[model samples]
Target: MKTIHKKNTTFLNLAAAALMVAALVLGCKPNVSNGGEVQPPVTDGCTITMSAGANGSITASPVIPAGGKVAKGAEITFTATANPGYRVDTWMVTPTKALTADGQQGDAIAKVKVTANTTVNVTFKPIVYTPVAYADLHNHLTTAQPETNGIYYIEITGLTAPDVTGNSIRDSASPLGQILNSNRQKKVALKFGAIAGVTDMSSCFNGCTSLVQVSDIPNSVTDMYSCFKGCTKLEHVPNIPNSVTDMHSCFYGCTKLEHVPNIPDGVTDMYSCFEDCTSLTSVTLKCEYLDGKFHYAFYDCSRLSTGSIKVPADSLDDYKDNADKMKAEAEWFAKDE
Candidate 1:
């Protein structure tokens, strides 16, 4: 037939060229050129960081966005760093317009606004603490006897004696006989081992007009009437501690004693002693018993006629007949010496 029909058309054109080379070796092989340019795939948002256990650490960025939608006011900002010695005293932001910066030198920065998912709080404080000192004089008859007003300064360093029955200090029952009739203490210092077991210091610094000072006097004190009655700034009268006997009214109104000490011979009774001192200038007596007859004992001593009056020349006729008013005050202080 025509060569078998042209061999079936050359076997159908070699099966159509072997199906187009097997579809070009399985779809066009090598076309590789990966020189970059492909990106696009990374989405992560919401982030915040801050920490401090001993002090230091803070950060905030990406607090939610990238399509996660949290933007109701978006404005977050935060930064803080300070470790070593730790110092960043203040920086705050906690719900309410948030905005702060102060401390850590400069740049502690802070700003807030993501309205919904919010939480901010920060605080720090420390500076100094240490100091103390005390001296509280007899602590107001022991622990401020129920504190009434206030006015205290204590420095009575070791009182010599006299605590009679003030309970040694406890609401004072006799605290030195009620501080010898206190007027709210203006100044007092009976310091240096305050004579103890006082016998009878009559009136004991009577109306102490803020006694200036009356140091050590305790030879086992015996008796001395009205001892310094209305002491209006007594000038001097310290030595008399020979275990005295009796010298009544001893310096009644020491208007400002000038001098009067040598009256030691176991005094019997010079009653009304120096009644109204009025600034007596002199007096020396070795008492052998004036027999208490100087009635008003130099009544208004008016400066004792201006000084000098020693007794004991053998009791000068029993002190001029039982001291006729102290022999007219020792002949008016021997006619003014």
Candidate 2:
């Protein structure tokens, strides 16, 4: 409680300051580097740098992205996506090593190991491809007839999908309908281009009795009258494009087709659409309405379960009671019955 002398107090304060300095020096010594400078957090990792080859970007996985770091021995993948009109031509990796590559051109991707600091260089080039054009092999001038063997054969080998949507160029305007049949010569393969500008598919394959296979059709089609009426051997029918509105007798006599794809809401006329599809078991006609025009649409779909008409579950009664009620009744009869 008594006042302390200044000389004695100064000596005690100096000793306290010495202890504090010693504790700090011990706590911080481990973090000092050889230069006596505080070091950054240490890490055992490598850097991976990716840049555009030509108007495109290179994406990677398991690599420190965006000027970052990844652990050594990590497996990394770099994928190239070329911009429009450009394609990936080559890759240049600094400190080069063997790389496992996959995919083609503009969509190429490669895998490599992270051993050292690396730089990825990709080169891109202009893409070149043949302008696709389709020619109708059968129509009014060349009715859907078969070869001397009485069978039609279609081989679509090198065709690829088009970039445009809902457009097609029809090879023939007045196609007779059944020319797609497989003539004992070979299977009918239509891997051809998507006929985008085409709008009419009426009677496209109507009487193809031996037509067992049909490729995907263009989504630009609108008319489909009597398209597959007599494709008796076709077991499975692909979905027609949603652009179709005129469905008059589209599948009238396709005796072996088992199901009908979803009918789009745009459809207004379904006159005799499935009149004679004898083996038909189901249909997806969620299209809320069918004004009397489809009365005989299912006339011969005898095998179709009453429940097979897959409408919105809430509107089953409405379909049977209102939309084309006559068709609901005609669903019982088959060809010649």
Candidate 3:
């Protein structure tokens, strides 16, 4: 009986030794209770770290705790937000955690499954606007409203000139017209960028009652028919392109226009070009009227009396010969060279 009890004790000792070896292999230790019974090993929670790159901020849903520790199988959500002129670029996860809800680069939301400690990072990039190619660049702002100060600020680049098919900026559907018709007393400031390859600008600013200034017209333009007509408050104008051949009713009803550039010699049509320009003081005629008449070109110019108009000395007789056709007093422009 004593030999049998000794054998039982030896078997219990071998079992305890095997349990210790197995615990070492599994990266855990057996815990002994007060009753000397072995208990399972305990595990600590994992950690998650998040960071945001420049020009943006990152946040997590359900809020990481104060210690940034989470359960081994918790699902964490991350969202990235970009500042103005910026956008989310990419996301990176360290140690290759399981992503249950993955998103491509530039997407703002993602979900990650944390099986181990991991670090999440997000990067941002700036937004760049590419220049549009030259073509019709009009009427895009037709429905845009002005700021509180009653001014429309606009910027456009690569604008090719429009043909005579009523595609000009002064057409009925034009934004410039909308801006003025919304409040005819307000002013508009416009800026142009890189204008090229343009040949026509007919009725470009017609009926813009509050326009007070304009940028230089490109020299490639050849037409100015009714271009600045009905700009009642415009006080100054850029030089007319030397390539222009038409000025039909170009400055009609310009109540505040104060000066006129020398008419280009290429002009072939000047009919009523300055009619009803109530504030025009003087003008010089360089166009010789070779084939076209200037009938009523200066009609109803209340501020332009006799001698207010000037003609080149070389063209005075030619102008005088056509004075009846021009509807101007022949003596009004014959003295000045």
Candidate 4:
């Protein structure tokens, strides 16, 4: 081999020595920084994004750090809330994160400790159910007759949740006769709702001496001949249905009745709707069709004076005597004040 040049050898030696010195300085560096232990190299953390389905929201505890970024070992609780008419269906976690609560894989609440990037999707579903509605119908009297005395009760079908405006309902034409003729019982409990099919109520509660209540007059009735002829203890008559055409002797002897319902404009015959109502002081006969007849409609109402009827008496000039009988025994009609 050719002999090496002196300058080249010297330069090589210098370079080798310089590299060794640099390595020593770097390896001997202090393990401290600003009086604190040195920290590991910085690395990116995991990311978590939540997706809530329609009409629902996800609430988290220890908030999944801002922007869905969290430490490697951080734990987060995700709760799903659904609005009215909805229920929680599932909490779908991506990559199958660690769940603290035991339940089906995709349903129920989840407490997750993230190991990597995660995504939780909340899926809500509409609750499914079916509802049923119906009614009961019974025939003949069911309640046992009173052990003693005059106590009677009757049930009316379609009374529960009835259509009040309905007028075709069917019921007993002579409910009182059926009850009294059997036992001659006195006390009566007339439970009823809207009258939808009843067409007659003649003598329905006639001669109920001990009947304290004359249940409301039916709206489906066309007749009321002596319906409450002798309900002496009845304190009130709620209303007279607009469908009634005849109200002869309807409240003929309700002596204790102080109030009478307004006579519907449809009534064509009021022979004695409120006859002998001695306690009544005022009356209204607003029927516009009443031209000349209502014979003794309020006859013997001793407390109601002549002219006490509230009809357009001038329009009934020919039957003033009948109109007079419509008022209390001597009471006069009430003129417009």
User: Which should have the higher lDDT, number 1 or number 2?
Assistant: 2
- Pairs clashing within candidate 1: 46-64, 159-193, 159-194, 160-193, 160-194, 160-195, 161-194, 161-195, 161-196
- Candidate 4 regions off by >4 Å? 1-175, 181-185, 194-196, 289-292, 312-331, 335-337
Per-residue C-alpha lDDT of model 2 across residues 117-230, encoded as one tens digit per residue = 777767787544322223444331144543332333343322223221211133221332323332322323232344436676676665666565454667777877776667
Model number with the top lDDT? 3
**Structural similarity to truth (TM-score) of each candidate:** 0.23, 0.46, 0.50, 0.44
User: lDDT tens digits, residues 1-337, model 3?
Assistant: 9999999999999999999999887555466687976665537677899999999999887688988888888888898866645557888887664667764576667798888878999998864432322232233334455443344444455454442213344344134344444556566544455556766667777787767555457788787877778888776576787899988888888987867777887888899898888878788777776535588787777776777877767778877777667666676675455
Query: Which clashing pairs does model 3 show?
Result: none
Compute the lDDT of residue 337 as modeled in candidate 4: 30
* Candidate 4 local distance difference test against the native: 0.59
User: Across residues 1-337, which tens digit of lDDT does each residue of candidate 4 receive?
Assistant: 2356877888899999999999998667655576676644426687888879897777776776677788887788776755543446667777674555632432335778878778877877653322111122112323444312133334444532222222112322243344443434344434455555767666766766555543455666776667777778665455778887777777788897765767777777777777788877676765643533466776777766566556555534434544554543333554323
Give candidate 2 regions above 4 Å deviation. 1-189, 313-315, 322-325, 329-337
Q: Which ten residues in a row have the lowest lDDT in candidate 4?
A: 129-138
lDDT of each: 0.52, 0.60, 0.69, 0.59
Order of candidate numbers by lDDT, starting with the best: 3, 2, 4, 1
Q: Which candidate wins on TM-score? A: 3
The order of the candidates by TM-score, greatest first, is 3, 2, 4, 1
Question: Candidate 3: worst 10 consecutive residues by lDDT?
Answer: 129-138
